[model samples]
Target: MPGKDAHNDTPRRVLDANFPDLALPAAVAARLPALVHCRRLASGRSLFVPGHRPTAFYAVAAGEIEARFTGLDGTVSVIEHVGAPRLFGLAAFAAGQPTEYEAVARGASEVLVIGREAYVLLMDEMPGFARALLAEFARRHDGTLRLLQAARHQSAAERFVLALAQLARERGRAAGDGWLEVTATQAELARLAHLSRQTANELLASAEAAGRVRRGRGHWLWRGDRE
Candidate 1:
């Protein structure tokens, strides 16, 4: 279970760090401190499950959240790993629909949640907030299209490489000269690339041989100069 923190006041720096996608004006920003609350989640705890109606928008303040989809047969697939400073559940929340996937904390995490009423108020009164939200939606739309195109036309190895590249760009940290470390297990990479674990392993071996990637225990170091 997620626990609400007693100290729920959202600071300006925290807001700037977590909601970088939203370019809120000073007026809109002034209102957020009162509208947002913080919740802490233990690893493997669910923030929200499928068919649940979203009452708030969430931005990861720390750690990661895994968005997963469960099929009729109960096979679960990882849809996305929403990491710190990223927003999740926006599509369902904005559309007033029940969430189709479960959002679970991947590690001990904290999130800043803005209730629906507050979101609506901002949307209605703040042009900057509305515009920023629309812009983020458009950006996600383009990213989804690219992923679909890659899945349709790219080879398995190509798809795997692309997935790694995307993760490295989005979630990786500088691991010294010319190397970027991405905190992801091979299973997570396989799921993200829509490849079997064995296939991902084989591709990774090949990439390792070619001096493209170095797999660590729970992460991968990508050569920044490599494609």
Candidate 2:
């Protein structure tokens, strides 16, 4: 569950920090203050569930959100983690369809919610904003394609390593003594890598033996050495 937070003024620095890749035009940026709302979500709380119609575009202001897909048998797989200063829910919102994945808070998080009407208005009125958003969509599409290719062609160990590398790049923080810590459980990492828990455990054991990664109680530590 998300609690409403009254946020009438959204600062430009905040937007700039959140969307470093997207350069919004002054016109679009100026209008965002009035068009956005803020919400706070506690850990393990859902921002939105599958099959829910999207009323707004969501961007992470702080903390992380996990995108998960639940099957008919009620099994859940984590699709990806969207950390602070990133956007999510763009696909469904842009297509005007119900979301297929559930967006859940990975920790206490702050999110910027832009209503669908405001988003459409910005797109219709600002060329620069529209182009920037479309480019972001293209970039994400390319990343997805690359992941799919790796899944189809790479060896299981190779895929696991790649997945860990990607997570380290996205979610890792310096933990001292040349180690980078990633905030994810082994089971979550397995799902993100599209591997079974047993296989991921085996691969991780091999890596640990090689002095590459160390598994913490609820996280992972990597030295960033890929060789």
So what's the TM-score on candidate 2?
0.75
Off by over 4 Å in 2: 1-14, 21-28, 120-127, 145-155, 173-181, 214-225
lDDT of each: 0.78, 0.78
| TM-score per candidate | 0.80, 0.75
Off by over 4 Å in 1: 1-11, 18-30, 121-127, 145-154, 175-179, 223-225
Clashes of each: 0, 0
The RMSD of every model to the true structure, in order and in angstroms, is 3.6, 4.0
- What tens-digit string does per-residue lDDT give for candidate 1 at 30-125? 676678877899999999999999888888888889887777998776666888777778888888899988999988999878788678767787
Worst 10 residues of 2 by lDDT: 1-10
lDDT of 2 by residue, 1-227 (tens): 33332253443555566456656677766676777877899999999998898888888888999888788998776667888777789899888899988999988998889787668766777556677788878877676666666777988887787678768866889988888999777877788778999999999999999898988888889986644
